[model samples]
Target: MPTALNRRSLSSLAVTAAAAALLAGGATAANAVPAAGGATAQHRACHVHALSDGRGAEVCRTWTPHGDGTYYGTWQVDRADANVIAQGRFDGKVRNLGVQGSYSRVKDFVTRACDSSGKRCSSWA
Candidate 1:
């Protein structure tokens, strides 16, 4: 026979374990590829437009997937001078027709520009 406190502790442990398992299953499901022509085919590569400082906006070229929807690309800004910006490897996903991902620059040129302008910016630096 166990005390009420012991039963409560066991119940709490069981609940925690169940929650962890559920979360792991959910993560696996999210990464799983759906049936072809069903939903996976509808997932497009993620893209981001070039940032403009109002002088003239830059044009971002199309990016192609490297592997498993991950992409690597580059964009050139031809405003004051020709500047090349490279986007490193990034993970892409599609959820309900919406594409999202995390992208980082291979270099710190963008952040340097922002910092020079005295504007607060977030970067890997």
Candidate 2:
């Protein structure tokens, strides 16, 4: 009978430890911000710049949710900019593109937009 009781006590202790671990993990997940495709969208900030020639540029910086250590950016231009960089249908024209960083720093994937004249540009996002 004593051996059976000891086994029962050990089993109860193991279950309690597992439950505590699960609770701790749940609390951490609850505090995290939702991802982009989740119920809540990732936070973002936008900026627009115009040139003397009546052309404009726009850029946005999107922060990653918790557990991700990087950020992303998007850019658009009404005309064209000499310094604008993009691929596949983007040429500083009236188009926008989303870019992400492979590393942990936002600067790893900075985006720039400029007017047609190339003299004016939106700050890197």
Candidate 3:
């Protein structure tokens, strides 16, 4: 009974809702855990977003056993883009990784993955 356009709109809305829920859940989980030395850690779960080339990229923040915060990222190959980039930034510090890489240092508050030329980017987490 629904038109094609209506269906597409509904689908898009569903995806957006799902993404929002995922982000909310991730934030809650991160807040509930206590970091090392009794400090609160800011960690986020992986979030996948579609790129312009139809590929996808994922960005995530993780806490080590010792409570060190790290950034993790992975992206699929897009023939149009030479390389995929993932960056995590916090407190004026930025760390970068490419095509399935994770930073070894503990420094991150937000994370995002992008395709070449920043054609497509994921929502910050």
Candidate 4:
């Protein structure tokens, strides 16, 4: 039997490994396809990350296909004091969602954006 901590470590490792594989696959697909003249497709993946201990904000956005091409997205923000919550969707499209919260809760911040193209993008500050 493994301890709780050990199990957690293993779980994290698994997640990391899976993410890496997805990213690698995405890169291969991107290279195979041509994006110069909209040849590949309009579908895209966008990752966003934002963090600020003082006064700042983060934003992430991606262009979905003209209609039902595929939409996958993620957004994250962190401030002096805030709680961090991450979300992901396999099939869903919600746009222009506004954000509001107190900035006296979190210490760090992170934002990740992923789409149907298997492209994962993120930013941190």
Candidate 5:
């Protein structure tokens, strides 16, 4: 009861529907990656410094990953001249590692250890 032209239009419609379904399925597959809980680990670091004259101080700062989604941060100034601007996230327990005016000496040279309980960057910095 349908004309040849009607059959052609119906065929075209079917093809378009199938193409759309395939595209939708493809999109779903592409989004499944992030949902698998296989997320990647992220990291961050910082530097705190304040230099003046031939006497100032600075320290490269970084946080340790605790595996359970936690972090511990520490800062260190090389010389007594490594001027200080920020104390980093050292919880004040690590002798002379922190942010403050300007460094004048290697006063409390950091031992580069982790204060398991101390933290600054949890998910990031």
Candidate 6:
């Protein structure tokens, strides 16, 4: 019993709703990626330096991956000829300060150190 104008409006509404539902379903199916628990891997790295007599020295460096968007590694430096351990975490590609409580935003640990300390350090990229 609707008017012709009302019928047209309802038809358009139904078409819009159908299109929206189709688009939503398509996006859900197409945008799916492997879960973090799956076979995907993530990696990150960083550098540590010890300063003595206003000079920075590299002690030790390493890079490791946990393959699930997490990483753990260690770096050592000699300040006054004593080893200083820097343990840190990498969230995918971002390095979080582990025991040192200092986060590095650089993609690689060594380049991150270069950006942080203004020194020529090796790259872990």
* lDDT values for all models: 0.26, 0.36, 0.43, 0.28, 0.29, 0.30
lDDT of 6 by residue, 20-76 (tens): 656766422111222334532222222234333333333233323344433334443
Best by TM-score: 3
Ranking by lDDT: 3, 2, 6, 5, 4, 1
lDDT of 3 by residue, 1-125 (tens): 00011111222333444456567774222324444466443332455545666565554434332334343322221222345576555444855554444444434445566775566676555
lDDT of 5: 0.29
Q: Which candidate number would show the highest lDDT if scored against the true structure?
A: 3
lDDT of 5 at 108: 24
lDDT (0-100) at residue 125 of candidate 6? 23
The 10 consecutive residues of candidate 6 with the worst lDDT sum are 1-10
Error of 2 at 82 (Å): 14
Candidate 1 per-residue C-alpha lDDT over 17-107 given as tens digits, one digit per residue, 9 for 90 to 100: 4456567674221123243344321111212223354221222222223334443333332222123232222222211111122332321
Total clashing pairs for each candidate: 0, 1, 0, 7, 14, 2
Off by over 4 Å in 2: 1-41, 65-68, 72-109, 117-120
> What is the Cα-based lDDT of residue 74 in candidate 1?
38
Q: Candidate 3 — which residues are off by over 4 angstroms?
A: 1-27, 34-44, 64-82, 98-108
Q: What is the clash tally of candidate 1?
A: 0
TM-score of 4: 0.20
lDDT of 5 by residue, 26-47 (tens): 4221112221155422222232
Worst 10 residues of 1 by lDDT: 1-10
After TM-score superposition, what is the CA distance of residue 29 in candidate 3 from its true location, in Å? Answer: 2.0
Better of 4 and 6 by TM-score: 6
Tell how far residue 31 is off in model 3, in angstroms. 1.2
Better of 3 and 4 by TM-score: 3
Total colliding residue pairs, candidate 4? 7
The predicted structure with the larger lDDT, 1 or 5, is 5
Q: What is the clash count of model 2?
A: 1
TM-score of each: 0.25, 0.32, 0.42, 0.20, 0.28, 0.24
